[model samples]
Target: MTYEPELPANSSPADAASSTHKPLHHKPVAKAIHPLNQAANAKWVPINKSFITLTRIILKSALERFGLVNLAITLRCVTQQGYRHLILVNDDRDIQIAAVGRVEEFIISTEMPMTPPAERLSAAEAVTFPVDFQGQRLGYLVALVRNPRVDPGDEIQDHPSASDIKYRLNRVAEEMVGVIKRYQTRYRAIYVYGDQCYWIGNSAALRQLDQRIDTLASSALPILIRGNKGAGKIIAARALHCERHTEIVPFIESGCHEWEEDAATSILQALFAYAKGGTLFLRSVDKLSGENLRVLQAFCTQRTLEKTTKGHAESVDIIFSLSRRDAELPASLQRWLSINTVDLYLPDLRERQEDIRDLTRFFIRECALGKEFDLTESAWQQLEAFPWTDNVEGLKRLIVQLSARAEHPLVDRPLLEGLMVSLD
Candidate 1:
């Protein structure tokens, strides 16, 4: 929900939005505030700052900067009245735009069942848009309207018809494609790899890690990414594959403990097939049994072979992930592979309380796409004070649960207190 920037020209948004869980079909969104609008609405015209200068150049090269396409998409969807507008291009037929307006209506109505029938119907009428951004027919729009209520003599005037939305969306899509092309040509500063925006305190350990990932990506060594659960190990692995030296192939990952020893061959075969000339991420390698251990060991020994074997390609890179940094790897395997290690340890939400607000802002915007949910100052304070043992994932769960149950659009301290007390 909290978007840092866009992906490179070679990557698709679907690839960028990759999650293990099936992603619910939701409307595409743009940024909360456009850089263009922010410049226009500033109180005083002072000397331009560096970010502002970059923003200006980015705007000038909107069609070229990969990040700008995402920014532009974010800006459009978060607009006051825009109901889930998608940027579609005639060139890209793989993109499919979901209808979020109806889904939002269903969620709202279901959440507020106690409202008077008249008011409920009135509320429904205002939000129901009849147009959608459908990427078809050199591209156009489609929509679903349920029981449009019209007064005796009144007419549905000034409403955005399907064609109108199609025309506007098509233009935006074309603009986005142009923006993507431009980014590829100019703006060398936009570093695609080792360029992740994250929340980390000014710790020497964390700073060292930031530098290490960049260096490690250049070498074709065995990498072992260690991190706590929910610490974004998968994200790190994906970032590694996107580096310059690696060929763009499907990322193959498997948890060592999840499969039994007998099932190792089938799993390895599947992984070897998926990661053909790409990266193979063995998550929780410490849990592998006697059988799977040998299979891995054999692959590493193949380095001594003079000729490239049928399946053993030099381009195939291997990465491992473990939960603990100091945990001992099985001694037999340790001698064979030198895991160019990266430890991704983030402080828990309670430990880094200052970041809760930023994280909350991110979660709020994400939930708001379906329903209106606001957090009072006191509510934020309550959240900041709580012990978030589960870190970011736990906070997300709480917000989603609260958003589903809250009576008002805005979440106040009282609502949070009531929920917390009930849990206690």
Candidate 2:
């Protein structure tokens, strides 16, 4: 059954005995939260289940400050509202008749919504809160109570009951909008000269490559990254351009196949002008002809005598990418563009099996936001068992399709089986 908070809608007869209830920041009883502890900012105060004496001490202090004497306070479980009770403490900080009254009201509202008031009240009194988290502040949550006789456990109860709490949560969500925003940057090391590098994984190969990149970024040597097709060569090139020590430079990306004789000349001239004190990434270095390679070599090796139409030559850095398939080219060609080659052996999705589960979970969470569906364990298992030929791209499409078809709260085995059958 759905649950709710137990609390009074209006001040009870006992409330007439209390005065103000302002929380004080400084007193002999006031203690400081640990420095750098973000948890202290949380609304719910932390207390151990066995710390009865500490609980009493804090409660007594709050009551004295609130000028409470004869008022009866109550604490009761919020259930659907929370995992624990809203600890209602009187102005005098005593948890007494109010707790019983609130718990009874909650039971009446949830279990016997249509029952007569006398029968519901009797049925409610039998239910009680086993634990309390709100401490003495439960009484202050008056804004959450609706019925004139109802007493709530905490102010942040379920919807309608905790309107104030919903407002607070909304405020928090709004303030956090741009705080976690992500951005992209591309840079080249002094050695490679390019940028566009954001990768996630804790593999040993990647760590070693990161170290190499750091060292290379500190030097002026030419660097080459050799990888397989779609192996993130462009990503590496962009990362090289975004080095911290270098000036914000233009990153020129040009493929060898995109150049004819005149086009290549014009592009090179334009690049030289734009790439002064920056980086130029030759996306597929393997596509350059022998004559063009020689010309590129001359351009890189030369010192600037004066600025030409293409600007100063000595300040620009060059990075090249070649696929491993192209790396096995004629020995004569290797000599033409040979420099410090860094092999990037990108693992196939099958080879990185350990990442599949985590990656799938991430993709599901990303795709399911604002959706009513969640994938069942069996459905996820089916996805995990399938052999993906297109790697991450294929997995993304499959997830999108599955999410589009989901109607229930979870994409169960039946849904997945049907999807798999259709695909096959």
Best by TM-score: 1
Cα lDDT of candidate 2 equals 0.43
Predicted structure 1: lDDT: 0.45
Give the least accurate 10-residue stretch of model 1, judged by summed lDDT: 38-47
Worst 10 residues of 2 by lDDT: 178-187
What does the lDDT read for residue 29 in candidate 2?
A: 13
- Candidate 2, residues 1-424, lDDT tens digits: the string is 1111111234344522321231211112111111222221222221223222223333344334332221112333333233333322333543343443333222211112324345223422222122222232232111112222343432333433244433442332221110111012211121223222334333334434444555565554566777655345665665565542223345556666554432333345555545556676776667777666666666555523232334433366667777553467657657654553444344444555555555565567667666646677787677767665555556666667777888787778877777665444
User: Backbone collision count in every prediction?
Assistant: 15, 33
Residues 1-424, candidate 1: write the lDDT tens digits. 1122223344445644542233322222111111222112111111113222333333234323211111222211211134322222222432222222211221111112324345223432322122222222222111121222433233444555545544544544444322322222111112222222233232333334434555577664567776655455665565555443222244466667765544444445445544556677788887778776787666555632522454435346677877554558777656554543334443334556655775676676676567767688787778988876566667777777787788887788877776665433
Off by over 4 Å in 1: 1-211, 245-247, 303-314, 324-355, 417-424
